[model samples]
Target: MAEITLFAAPGSCSRVATIVLEEIGVPFTYELVRFMKGFHKSPAYKAVNPKGKVPALIVDGEALTENVAILSYLAATYPDGRVLPAASTPMAAARIIADLCFCSATLHPLVTRYCMSVKIGGEEGAAAVKAVGAEAMKENAALIDQRLCEGDWWYGDAWSAMDAYLYWVFGRFNGAGYDLSPYPRWQTHAARMEARPAVQRALAHDEAAQATLSAERMQMGPGGAPKAA
Candidate 1:
């Protein structure tokens, strides 16, 4: 396989896929798209991802957008890595997809929308957006916590792409002050995910980004809310 290159930004959804790559032991490169500099919105970056978002995977010269697609593709191509189940049946695959959707459609988006309300709309709309977003995320987090309570991983016994995404979203919320004390299982999940070698690697790479994020959160006053990218 051609070396996979991930065009990513620190603290972006792309980081989830990047961590997947690390866990799978795939050789890859990561290019940081500086959010503060608006590099992701640049014409150069847009050429790679029309949405101009981070976490675009370049396999050879073809770019794959969206963390869900990239993660699934990596798991499919590297079955030996076993980061996700091969799914002996279609129904099994459907279950994994369902879990992934909970993260992508519900958890991830809610966090992103709330944090970036000022950029998506304006400060005038932020409070209303955050109120709705928080309720939605809390509900979504509760659902995932329920799943974690049932099993060690999001997809039963094995680690899956959904686990990586869920863990990342969980960290984002807790780090931003959503109060993980209410969700004990999810808090435990975050702690375990952080201890993984792959996750630790991702965090090391994301150190500078985390600093910027901390500063941004302080500026936002709660939520680590951001200007929408």
Candidate 2:
């Protein structure tokens, strides 16, 4: 068995990977990367993941970054279809892969640009970007809601890591003060995800790490920079 260690930050996109790890029931060490505590920028963490991002899965001391890559790995390594659904063909495998890309490459950046638009761009630019984000979010939510309405999960009857990733991205929109009531179906799906034992466990891991960050007085500032703890 490979010794695994996950360097994760609480409540970030890393939550998706954390959920899958719990779903796989794997034995791995959780190394909290306190982003606000300046650990992510630390030399030690950079040694682990040069990108200095959270949710870097270290397997036998080798690093794997990105939610899509990490999820794909857990699926391939565990081969239990817990991280993802077992595909009979390459095309079937690509289905979920495409969805992951949509969430990570597409929606993820939109939410960040939307939520942090004011910070990223000036007030005038913020208005322009916010409108774009709103429109894009609505279009994506409609597609997601339509698909989710067909099945209990994204694939229409099976729960996969994609669900976790969707929950994270969609919830980020909601968290950013965008109304999700229009997509009641995905909202319900989000609630269902929240009720999962595995999800709860992952959230627990997140909360514990956040509590530590809070105690250390290293909460991120208004501009996303770490404040002195």
Candidate 3:
């Protein structure tokens, strides 16, 4: 097997790939892309991923982007690893893909809109955008919470890659002060994800990467000049 390299950013959706990789129990190299510092837009990184997105997986010298595609690839390549649900039938497989698509295409953008309303909407319009995004997020969260209330995992009996994606999204919004108290089932789902060893390891790596970035930023003064200690 060829060497696998994962280009990721801490606290981003890229963490999904890291968690899946950890679950796969395969040897791979992780390269942190400091997205907050605009490292993803650098020429070097742009060469790797023209879209300038995190979670680019380099397998056999070819780069793969997007959570849906990458996660699907991992699941397909390592059937025995069971990174995703082992669909017993064609319709079952489609349902799993549908859930993944719903997360990426619908839920994620709403969260992103709320989190980056200032960028998505002009300064004068940011408040309106955030308000609308929050309402939509709340509705979506409720649906997810209702589904999760039925079982321990999203897909009834087993944990799938969708759980990792949902956990990250829910965790991000919760951290951003979204008042998740109304969604106890969602909270419990996140707690269960936190209890997973692979998730714990991935979170530790994310925290360490974030700390390193924070320390590096602190060393620089307000204008990007080195601070005199």
Candidate 4:
């Protein structure tokens, strides 16, 4: 077994970890959890990550949850990769960590809440919640645009996991039915990011999973519950 193993679901924020692992040129095995069946909530997975979040990494037998920790671990372990700041520059590393937290903690969850709130709150209440979520999405998008306008990447000219996380969160806007044209810089960032081999590979994997799930649902007929790929 590979020393580094990642438990992830395709198209989730776990994609960021996949990108970071690829960027750092680290080899690892992927353990895919069937989310639709509540695989993440099973006892077996809780041993790996008690929080039950995707992108949990088992490195040298110690499981690390949260994207920031996993990403920073990869970058720092492979410091020569140049995808992250040097440990010697504590301030720089701190800034990148900050950006990672903001995106993971704030931007990503807002979009997720907007998407799933209907299940928690009733449909009528969900509409109002989603409205607020949509506006927040725009504000976050604008914030990212302003950052990109100031510089090519979030931290600096060199791309880092921050850019990858930004790409993942902002990409959610398209599904949320937000107008992306206003954030030209974000669009440009997405274009540049899509050209990267790592991101391309991750996205292709996600799309394939979605297609497979769709086909399976079609086979099972109307009574069959469509599983989230």
List per-prediction Cα lDDT, in the order shown. Answer: 0.78, 0.86, 0.87, 0.79
Regions more than 4 Å wrong, model 1: 208-229
lDDT of 4 by residue, 1-229 (tens): 3499888787788888877777776787767766876888989998888887797999889999999888887776777666665655878667777877898889877877677668656777888777778777777888889989767788658888888888887677676667889999999998888999988877766676667656655664456765433
Ranked by lDDT, the better of candidates 2 and 3 is 3
Which pairs of residues collide in candidate 4? none
Backbone clashes, each candidate: 1, 0, 0, 0
Alpha-carbon error at 101 in model 3, in Å?
A: 0.7
Best-performing candidate as measured by lDDT: 3
Highest-TM-score candidate: 3
Question: Model 3, range 22-109, lDDT digits (tens) per residue?
Answer: 8887888888898767889999999899999988999989999989999999999988778788889999989888989998999888
Off by over 4 Å in 2: 122-124, 218-227
TM-score of each: 0.87, 0.90, 0.92, 0.87
Ten consecutive residues with minimal summed lDDT in candidate 3? 220-229
**What C-alpha RMSD separates each model from the true structure?**
6.1, 4.1, 2.5, 3.1
